[model samples]
Target: MAKKAAVLMLILFVASLLAGCWNRKELNELGIAVAAGVDMEEGGRYRLTVQVVDPGQVASQQGGNGGAPATLYTSEGDTIFEAARRITQISPRKIYFSHLRLFLIGESLAKRGIGQMLDLLSRDHEFRTDFYLVVTKGTTALGTLKIMTPLEPVPANKLFSSLETSEENWSPSLSVTLDELIDNLTSQGKHPVLTGLVITGDPQMGQTKKNIANIYTPTQLQYSGLAVFKKDKLIGWLDEKESRGYHQIHKGVKSSVVFIPCPEGGKVAVEYIRGKTNVKGKVVQGQPRIDIQVEIEGNIGAVGCKKLDITDTATIAKLEKEVEARIIDFVEETIDKAQTKYRVDIFGFGEVVRRADPKAWKAMKNNWDEEYFTHLPVAIRADFVIRRIGTISDSFLNQTKE
Candidate 1:
C-alpha cells in the first residue's frame, strides 16, 4: 500500500511540473501593439510610436463607436530599444509587440539611415519578420499612423490589406516585408524599395472620430508610389508609371491592366493574367551586356475602340504586338531611370552577373553599381500573347450595324 501511494505521488508531481504556466502573461497586463512607427527627432533622438489595440472597443458589436479601435503611444530616447522601453512610462500595461503587423519609417529617418533601426528589429526577440515595412512620404511616421481609415477600423489592418491587394493587382506598388528588406540590405547586388504612404486630406482632422463618421472622410490614408533605397538609405521616389516599369524588369508584376491605343481610334484594355521575366548578363571584352526576356499572357478586358474586331486573327495579332511593345517600353524606361537618374542597381543585375560569370563579378563586385552597372548595355524583348476577349467576341459598339 505504501509503494502504491509513492507511485501515485510521483505521477502527480510530474503532472504538476508539466501543467503550470511557464511564462504566461495576463491579457490585462499587456498593451498589444498592432503597428509601430519610427521617426527621427532633434539631437539624434529616436521617436517611437505604437498603436495598441483596445480589446473592448475592437471586439464590440456596436461598430466600435465606444472609442478608437487602437490607441497611439509615443516615446523618445537615444535608441530604438530605449524609446520602446520608455513607452511604459505613459502606458499602464507592458507594451507587447508579438501582434505587430506594420512598421513605418518616416522620410527623415529613412534618409538619415535605417541600418541601425533594422539591426535592432532583427535582434529583438519580440518582433517577427512577417510584418510589412513602409516609408512615409512627405509626412512623419506618427502623422501617417494618426490618420484613421474609413474602410478598415484598424489602421494597421488597412495598411496591411491595402499593400497585399496593391501588390497582387497593381504593378506600381511593391510590398516589402521585414525579412525581404533585411535580405536586400545584406545582399551585395540588390537594393530595397518600400511602398510609400501618404495622407491625402487634412492631417489634424484625421485623428478625430468624426473623420470616420462622415459620409466622406475629411482625411484619408493612401498608398503612394515606391520609395527607392540604396542599401538602407532612401535615395528617391518613383512615380506610378516608373514604379510599374521597375516591376516589369524585376518580375514583380503578377496581375495588372495595360491599356493600348488602337491604330484607328480609342484604346483596348488588356488584363495581364500571368507574366515572367528572365534577366541574363554577359561580358564581352570587358563590357557588360544584359538581356531581359519577358513573357506575358493576358486577356482583353475592355474594347474602347468601336472599329476593332475581336474575332479577327489579324486584329488580335496587332493587339498583341502593341502590348509587347508597351511591355518592352516599361522595362527599357525603368532601366534608363535606374542607370542615369538613381545610378542604383535595383534590378539585381549584379546578381545576374555573379551567376553568369563569377570571376568577372568578383572583380567588379566593389564597383558594380557605380562603374559597371551604370554603363551596362541592356536589351529587352517581350513576347505577349492574348488568350481571350472577355465574354463577348466583339464589342456591342460593333453590333450597332446589325
Candidate 2:
C-alpha cells in the first residue's frame, strides 16, 4: 500500500512540474510583422525598420478603403538583435515576424557584406527561409519603406506583385529567397543574385490630379536593372540591355520585344514569344571549350521600312538573320564583359562545367574561377525565327511608299 502511494505521489509531482508555465506571451501582446528592412545607422550601428499591419484596420478595409495602409516603426541598436529588442520599448506589443513577405537590405549594408546580417536571420526562430531578400538601389533601406502605394492599398504588395510579373516577362533579374541565397552562398560552383528595387517618385502622384490620363500613371510601378554580386558583396549594376543579355544566357527570359533598325531609315519591332538556350562543353589540349545555341521564335509587330516585304520567304529569311545577329552581339557583349571586366562567373557557367565534367570540376574546383573562366573558350550560335507578322497583311508604310 505504501509503495502504491509513492508511485501516485511521483506521478502527481511530474504532472505539477509540467503544468508550470513561465514567459508565456499572448497573441494580443505582440505586433505582427509583414515586412522588415535593415539599414546602416550613424556611429556604426544598425537601424531596423518594421512594417506592421493593424488587424482592426486590415479587417475593416476589405476591397477598398482599407485601414491605415501600413505603419512603419523603427528602432536602432549596436547590433541587429539589439535593434529588434529595442522595438519592444517603443511599441505597445512585442514584434512577431512569422508572416514576413520581404526583407530589404540597404545598399551600404549590402556593400559592407551580407554575411553577418545573414547570421542573425538564420539564428532567429521567427524568420522563415521562404521570404524574399531584395537589395535597394540608390537609396537607403529605410527610405524604401517610406513610400505608400496606390493600387494594392499598400506599397509593399505592389512591389511583391511586380516580382511575379517579372518572371512572366523577359527580365534578367531574379528573386532570391532566404533559403536559396543561403544555399548558393554555401554551395560550390554557384553564385547568388537578388532582384533590385528603386523608389522613384512620391507615392501620391495622382491623388489630386485634374487630368484623367494622369490618374493611371501614378498607379504604375517601374522595375529596372539588377545588382550583380561577388559572393556576398555588391559589385555592380546591370543596365536594361545587359539584363536582357543575362536573361538570354541563363534562360530566364520569358517574352520581350526587340526593335531592329533597318537600312531603309526605319525600324522593325519583333515580339519574342519563345526562347531556349543550350550550352555544351568539351576539353581540348588542356583548354575548356563551350558552345552555346540559342533558338528564338518571334513575330513582326511593326514595320516602318517599305523596301522589305516580310511576306516573301527570302525577305523573312534576311530579317531572321538580322534579328539573330543582334541577339548574338548582345550575348557576346554580356559574356565578354562578365568574363573580362567583372571576372565573376555570373552566368553559372561554372555550374555547367561541374555538371558536364564532374572529374574535371573536382580537379580544378579549388580555382575554377581563376584557372577556367579567364582562359575559357566559348562559342555561340543563335537562331531567330519570325513566326508571324501582325494582323495586317500589308504594311501601311509600303502602301504610302507606292
CA lDDT of each prediction against the hidden true structure: 0.89, 0.77
TM per candidate: 0.93, 0.84
Q: Compare the candidates by lDDT and give the number of the best one.
A: 1
- Highest TM-score: give the candidate number: 1
Query: Residue 144 deviation, candidate 1, in Å?
Result: 0.7
Model 2 over residues 1-402: C-alpha lDDT tens digits? 999999999999999888956767787987888789898865788999998877776556463353365777899988999999998888888888888878888888888788878998988998988778888887777777766556555556766777767756756556678988887777666566677777666544422222113444443335667677888888887777777787788763558878888887889888889888998876666556788998989999899877777888888898899888988887888878777877777777777877777777787667877778866788889999988988986787777734
Name the lDDT of candidate 1. 0.89
Looking at model 1, which ten-residue stretch has the lowest summed lDDT?
245-254
Task: Report clash pairs, candidate 1.
Answer: none
